[model samples]
Target: MAGAAELFVWWVLAVVLQVFLTGPLSWLEWTVAAGAAVPAAFGARAVRRASGAGSGGGARALHAVLVWPVALVADTGRLASLTLRALRGRQVRGRFQTLELGRGTGAAWACTLLSATPGAYAVGLGRGRFVLVHTLPGPPGVLADALTDGRRS
Candidate 1:
């Protein structure tokens, strides 16, 4: 099932790219696209299986698409501001701290989302489901607060 999903996604992307880069897709172009997509899709499926992430790849992908863009833009703005401040010779102190993320899949999801935010990275999981993260100089709770704040809404 995952392989089929990956194959479909890649083929769609290839067709779009081919059309944009060249022109309307010819039968030859489509055959070439399918040939290329097959191996890539299988490779992706293999990796996904190895990762042991829960099923429903399509849902996870959809959730990411819905939530990521706004979060990314906000994080980018914050990171740029911090960078400008540092360039002005202001002293900055970054630190590592552990945040209490509840157990199970939600914790895993939160850790991944926090890691993707700018100016922060989840180093690893800590004792009791805590997520150890490093962040640019700011309140120790900044990232944690951001994560929880999003949850409330």
Candidate 2:
């Protein structure tokens, strides 16, 4: 019953996302979206259950979505600046920094999300929920700063 509920929820989310991405759809498009949603929903449900990530992820997921584009754009600009600075004979340093991580799903999601941006690459999840990330010299992007604050702040 719980799995069924979760699957249904995932299906709805998949359909909604399809609509959001594609805009208004004709009957054929709706049929295609509904068909594609089943596999997408099952994949989401499987990943969630297999990973054993508990509920209460909605806010985190929403936060990640909001953070992603900003991080991408900010990091892109930062990278361009670094390139120009380096071309002008300024030193560009890349450093590895350790950030504290919360136990459970937050660490994985945070690392994955942070690494998706251009300026930071999470090296590993280390001792006591610490993650090592290598970042280009500059101000950390929004995602990295939020992640460095350790799941709250």
Candidate 3:
């Protein structure tokens, strides 16, 4: 029952967001549509149960949608800058370094942020003690600063 409720809520929220973006539907229409979606939420639980998955699909989907745009913009800027530098045949120094991160989900979040940004990628982890990252121009310190501050890290 909980799973169904979760699924319904996810679908309704998705519909609401779509209506908001499309802007063709009036608020009353959106509200009505959202209310109607409530029953479909149960389907989410069934899908998860059938797949034997534990994670909340709705939350994951929402996170992906939210993060992807930010990642794309950051990557685009990085690629443009790198391209400009490459045109001059500048010696692009690259750096590989490990960073100690707080345990658990924070580490994952940090890695995602780094991987999404341009000219940087989280390649691996070592000793479960640090995250390994590769960066162009060989300034691991700058990258570290960004990551630590929750900006580009």
Q: Report the number of the highest-TM-score candidate.
A: 2
lDDT of 1 by residue, 1-153 (tens): 755765576556555556656777779987886687667656645554675543333444445435655666766787788788889998766778666642233444455566766756888765554667787665533445544433210
Candidate 1 error regions (>4 Å): 1-65, 106-109, 139-153
RMSD of 3: 8.1
lDDT, candidate 2, 95-135, per-residue tens = 88887653333564566678877888988766655778898
TM-score of each: 0.51, 0.61, 0.43
Runs of candidate 2 with Cα error greater than 4 angstroms are 1-57, 102-105, 150-153
**At residue 46, what lDDT does model 3 achieve?**
57
lDDT order, best first, reads: 2, 1, 3
Instruction: Write out the backbone clash pairs for model 1.
Output: none
What TM-score does structure 3 among the candidates reach?
A: 0.43
Q: Report lDDT (Cα) of residue 63, candidate 3.
A: 49
Candidate 3: tens digits of C-alpha lDDT, residues 1-153? 765556755586557656756788877888876776565445544554564434433443444446655655655676678778889997556677666643232344456556756756889765543678887663443334544433233
Give the candidate number with the greatest lDDT: 2
Candidate 3 lDDT for residue 28: 89
Error of 3 at 5 (Å): 13
